[model samples]
Target: MPKVTFVQMDGAEHAVKVAAGTTVLEAAKANDLPMVGTCGGSMVCATCHVKICAADRARLPPPTEDEEDTLDLAFGVTADSRLGCQIELTDALEGIRIQLTSTM
Candidate 1:
């Protein structure tokens, strides 16, 4: 399993362990974190937007074109922004940090 930490707007940290290959959005949902996957991880919506921590961003591959387009619809998008559903967990991603963002 890989551990992921979700940082809240208030700087609260919620750490959860998930199986490798589980998407970030799925990890959040399974742990009861406040994340929305309106399109059910189908890559059709940006409700699962999250920001990868600057230092950990290198652990992930670049977002796909479709993911980039959908992420444009999320509020507070940043240079490190990514749709949670598009990020699959891996042993290499253990201890990754992701910041929650608004669905709108």
Candidate 2:
């Protein structure tokens, strides 16, 4: 299992241990973290947008073209922006940290 931390807007940290095959969005949902995956991990809606911590960003796979296109429409987008559904957990990503892009 890999541990992930979701940083809330108010600076609260919610950490969970998830299976290697689980996506960030799925882990968040399973743990009752505050991330909205409006498109159900289809990469269609950018509602699951999150910002990978600088230390963890390099550990993730590069975003797909579809994810990149969709993320362009997300609020509070940044260089580290990524759709949570697009990030699969891995042992290499242990202690990964991400910030929810929006509460909604």
Each prediction's whole-model lDDT (CA): 0.89, 0.88
lDDT of 2 by residue, 19-98 (tens): 99999899989998888898899888898999997778987778888899999889888888999999999999999898
Enumerate clash totals for all models, in the order shown. Answer: 0, 0
TM-score of each: 0.95, 0.94
Off by over 4 Å in 2: none
State the TM-score for model 1: 0.95
Best by TM-score: 1
lDDT tens readout by residue for model 1, 19-100:
9999998999998888989899998878999998778988799889999899878888899899999999999999999999
Model 2: number of clashes? 0
Query: Residue 90, candidate 2: how far off, in angstroms?
Result: 0.9
lDDT of 2 at 24: 89
